[model samples]
Target chain A: MKEETIINFTHHQTAHCENGVVSNLMKHNGFSVSEPMVFGIGSGLLFCYIPFLKVNHAPVITYRAMPGHIFKKFAKRTGIKMKREKFSNPKEAQSKLDENLERNNPVGLQVGVYNLLYFPDEYRFHFNAHNMVVYGKQDGRYLISDPVMEEVTSLSEKELEKVRFAKGAFAPKGHMYYPISFPEKLELEKAIVSGIKDTCKTMLAPIPIVGVKGIKTIANLIRKWPKKKGIKTANHYLGQVVRMQEEIGTGGGGFRYIYAAFLQESGKLIGNEKLIELAKEMTEIGDLWRDFAVEASRIYKNRSRNDAGQSENYNQVANQLDHIADLEKVFFKKLKKAI
Target chain B: MKKEEVPQDKSNLESANFRELCYAIDENGEYTTANSTGWEPKTVALNNAIDEINDRIEDAKKRVLEGKTSPIEYHMELHKMDVGILASYVGLWQWRVKRHFKPSVFKKLKMNTLQKYAEVFEISVDELKTIK
Candidate 1:
């Protein structure tokens, strides 16, 4: 006999998946942490261009930190005790998940995006780092709260198992996590300060492949791509950049808007006027990134518009990125001072 | 973007009955969340990616029909997998997977070998042996 259980879990849609799951789970555990706060405290924003790591036959250009990093960092900074487990055997994984549900425990699960049947058709791809919460089991189906979705959904036992053990890069391996305990009081002000400091240091890091320097490196490549790799491959690479920035549940502008919102809330909470001022500046920067995406997409979509015009468009977008990089360099320096 | 300026452009996602959340500055000059049907630039990029995948699948189907490559290649493309990913799923080396792409090599694959691939693709052994 199957024991049916459903824990009362609320679903709140957010701009990104991991942050959404983290925020929602915290709420269920009686801590009302907003999505942007979770993102900010976790220091989730980042820019890295790894040339050797190929995803979909193009170089990996990531706009944020790696999968699971946000939740891990958020828990650590807030002094939340979380229990995480991974299983090598599917049967064991299934039984463990069932046991948790029987005890009315809601758990966050790392899964592959490809096999998630509820995803929109266009968003279904072989990406392996998606996260969701499983709060209940009823009639042999698992109730799911995918942070990217507008409402809660469900999946059959076989379907959930497939994604949990999905193959390829960053495979889930049946990974599940949930909060076991929390500090009597969260040190929000200190966490926010440290988070801001860490982010500032990362963005200003002295490295070619990460932070502000990485943004410049991509801008340089955008200018060279048309001539170096020919129009077709160059356009494909440009599409990859846009997809990473806009798609993948980023809430747009590669999380700049979310970070700005975080700063605004943090400023109000900690009574820091400087952070409020910088939040406005960050919003403008996010707008600049959206503008860059527009121009980049135009170039890729209209490659046959004209050769001279195409190269000119590429340069224009590259210039836009360079300008954003410069702005970010200044912004992070200011943010570091403000905090 | 301003809350009012948050784009609600008609996009492919609209047909999917989903709205993505966006953070923007509202009328009060405060940050707030809004639901976006889609943005044009993102839609174009997303469509381009989907088109590319569809094109690859079509090309793979043509090759399989001509017996130029094995059914494995077509099925892999259909599943949005490349050599590296497919190899990982099947617990085989990438080079080995590539070698099996030849029609001749695929024809003589052992039952267990074929079973491994069938399980990965979620198809039957006989189904894996032929092009759809």
Candidate 2:
């Protein structure tokens, strides 16, 4: 293997190990455990097999939003009927919005109420609901532009029309319109877990063999042995030497370059001792990513209760994977410099 | 009771003298019926009596334009006779025009200057087309 590639793999392995520790710590706390769920599952399995995947800094929960159905379910479960009250008139809605604004709350916590009115030339079946997404404290309200889908793609307008016009409690078309088909809940959860595992594995690929004849020759000699037997023995021998080199390089010019870049981005500088402490703290990134993946997968699984599209599920997983990749890049760059 | 009757007698005599004075002014004609406070006829004096009525009308108009008056109150004052006359003043036309064209922009426009500008420019009726 090339020296840089071997070094990169070593860093990746170390990052994964650190992530595992952080995951355990997080589990010990009130937070959820990092199970082999979502894209993290495959990544976790790969890390278990390889000795080099490593990272720093446990992932922190940054953003979350309530899905439409989830919010509806929550309201139902709580028996909180969200009745549409007469807000005097359209003008009064603005005043109520203003009144709510004086109470200091996070922008995300604000409730947005909207009146869905259809305009001319729009499809009756695909009518866009005018929505208001209230945000900011100065009584500022922003209109949310996204629309909620009320029916499935398979159901025709005629079928929907019958539902809309249907009367009585037993009306099938109006009361319960299925938007998407869902798999068995357990099966859906398993699939989501498997997707997470695959993502993590892809992020930590095998170290490339080029440029360093010495390491490559050794790796080649090891390859001659049984695959499983050789990998374990080779990693053990290589890991020790790599660890020592990393320690020595910590005080060198490479460390200064990493620190300077980090300081510039963060707008905070630390002494060498503090920098070392931060570096140690960051070693938990892999574990945090694992936890994030597991939680995200669980959320997706819960969402599967209501029929959701394959593309929707895929998009959710893709977003988590993107976040994981971003974390990986930061960890790798730092580790590469440290080595 | 007798002492109370003496004060009553004095007031009655005073009222009698007042009635005689009214009669001396030819109160026997239709003017007699018109002279009583409640029975008074509507006259030109009634209109002229309210000297500051124009000012009150202007005030009410300004308040309505400023959004200080509720919709119900605005319509009520707008329909009032004296206030309606103030609506004829050049200032009211300017106020209405400024409110029509650019509400926020005209809100800052001085009342006096706006009235003068409307008169000098001969912009009648405060119509949207006339403002341009």
Candidate 3:
């Protein structure tokens, strides 16, 4: 029998997977980083509507930056060195993971969500951008630290490999990453400012398919979906939007709440009252998002609704989204000036 | 959203035995993390998506029973994958994947091709050959 190896890794449940994994890894490395800090410093927020791309038969709407972007940016801004490796061969990937465990290193991995047996059944889908950490190997089962989960779990060798190499859009392809080096002291203030600036620029970008413009574009689509796609398809599209906003792990309200928390934390740290005030405004915007979701879901829930009723509900939801877009536009502009 | 206002609506997450962590402002006007049982709107959207997938699975099963398509279609839906995604996993072209949907074409497929599909679904070649 092979010897067992387990690193002393602390599991911290977090709102989103990527940020949680990054923060947990930092804690393991003797750096106490909060999830919001990781999210903010990594500039993890975004709103992109990719009408050309399809996921689960609906146009893709993402609430966060692309997978691995957070860790990549966090490492770059803080002068931390990260080692990311992808393997074409499953055998080599498993061996490399085992090697890391033997060396007492907990490795972060990007895996598909569908085959995560430990995940809640309702949450398992064909999403391929989920992140987790493997901290040890014991009796042919790997110890998993999925930050979104409440507790640590274990997966057998086959189960682990299947998700590690799960195939599809944004397929993990046996991707593994971990921090290799850290500076003697991280420049937190500089990193925070840079991250905030990057987010402000992205959120205020002039592109129609992204940023604040993207939110309005979605609002426009929501208004037309009922007439153009019929009630069945339109409701499905609306449900898709809500799922992307809330179900796919945004800490509720499509990451707005998370960003507000980030601003609040950074405001206290940087001694900026303006940012603290703006965080309250952001929270209100988040409440508006939740209201939009609730209103949209009402349309899809009442399947036997008359055409007139359905269209009115759609209009209301679309109006709510437009309001959110406007609020976010003004909020980002104010945040930009505050920073 | 305020800390006390965080929704614990007792949705699908209750069955999953977990609560989602959410960010909220406390009474003191400070940011805090709170655990939510679930939210109603999220639960509705999640159930809708799952129901849609189940509906597709049922349709695929009907086609398989009528012998209008191969077991591959049923298994594909059961595994929560589309033809394009399944094609990528099996290293087959999209046209070939659609062609294999026909019972006759799937029957003529060789062991190697069958092995590829079976590997993807994590089932044996024999299991891939027949509907359960």
Candidate 4:
């Protein structure tokens, strides 16, 4: 007679969602892995500015690895047994999740950001790849451990289903996963080397819309905002960038700081002083990202009353992004050789 | 974000019973910690998005009251989705969704289509048929 049950899931708040969800799930499953360590070993550091991919009429610029990649890579690196499932039928998915929870297992879920009632109305959007965990159900509520929030929250079963099957880019499709077990030995050094190499490769990729090239492309487009797009249009675009970098649950610096934290932990674990140095540089670069957001925000402070937007202001912010791109190029190359 | 820079006046943050925790570079330039109070810019970013959503809702509600559209359109607006997004969830094409916006077509929508939208919105088919 399997029925409703609540797992004693201890929630530890962290910088990013996927990293936090997987980290907390690991902890509940008897593995001791820090959020940053999970982030690092999974090769979560990345910069892709795919301009053609539009969300809300702006280019998709991201500062981390693609969704679900970190968890997949982390499980593989640590030799942990993990199970993931997606359902064509929401009812089946909910039943499977209920069965898992009935056994006291906490399940990680990917959901859209727009419909979670606990989310600040201002922060809700059509973003479809946010991650959280469901530990149990009681009465008519699903207990959720969303890492970005300060505390655990509850969602109605119906509300949970709506978000689970939310449509758009990177749709969750009722996706859920749980860790089964882990090997005694972890391949830390091997994972570190591969992570550094992949990050460098993405930065040096030849395509103009990815890696460092993509940053350059975005910089050029941003610089032309005032002249080509006009003040009102420029304000809208700049606000969009700020929203992507600062708001979209990045926690900070478009998630560069989290990757930087990962680098720090990996450095100490592997005793690579050079990695420590690279981590410091990454932190500095992360500051530059914050600076870019601040300056861009200054350019269009009040969208309704903004009258001072200039080509120079747009160009100046563009130069800073280009500068950041160049700095990342240097950091990634050094990271590639630091190992 | 710095401790001094946290915004304490965002009403929605408290209303939703949600608080944002951020990773900020400390004095030693390390990113190993987190701050859950609030950041000014992050709060502002959210405030902007909420404003956008509310604006859409207001526009959508106006459209529906005038009989230019149906409750499906208003619900989608409240959810901050376009026809493309709503279509994908309902497994319908964008044109069908566009047609669904019209009251005449929406009234004749099959039970299956109505059920799909009801599931998407977390509302009943009866409620979905009438805009509040």
- Best candidate according to TM-score: 1
Interface RMSD for candidate 2 relative to the native interface: 47.8
* Residue ranges of candidate 3 with Cα displaced over 4 Å: A304-306
CAPRI-style grade of the A/B interface in model 1: medium
Worst 10 residues of 3 chain A by lDDT: A302-311
**Which of the predicted structures, 2 or 3, would earn the higher TM-score when compared with the native?**
3
Question: lDDT tens string, model 2, A1-339?
Answer: 111100000000011111222222223223332311111222222211122321110111101111132223322322223322223243444434334333321111111111122211111111111121222221122221111111101222232222222221111121111111222222223332233333233333454321122223333333332233333232232222222112111111112222222322222221233324333333244233333334333333322233334334434534544454455545534433431
lDDT of 1 by residue, A204-268 (tens): 99999899999999989989988898887788889889989988477779999999999999999
Ranked by lDDT, top first: 1, 3, 4, 2
The full ranking of all candidates by DockQ, starting with the best, is: 1, 3, 4, 2
- CA deviation > 4 Å runs, candidate 2: A1-291, A294-306, B1-132
TM-score order, best first, reads 1, 3, 4, 2
Candidate 1 residue spans exceeding 4 A from truth: A303-306
Model 3: pairs clashing at backbone N, Cα or C within 3 Å: none
TM-score of each: 0.97, 0.16, 0.97, 0.88
Which candidate ranks first by lDDT, i.e. highest? 1
| lDDT measured at residue B94 in model 3 versus the true structure, 0 to 100 | 88
When candidate 1 is compared with the true two-chain complex, its DockQ is 0.74
Docking quality band of candidate 3, CAPRI definitions: medium
Clashes of each: 0, 28, 0, 0
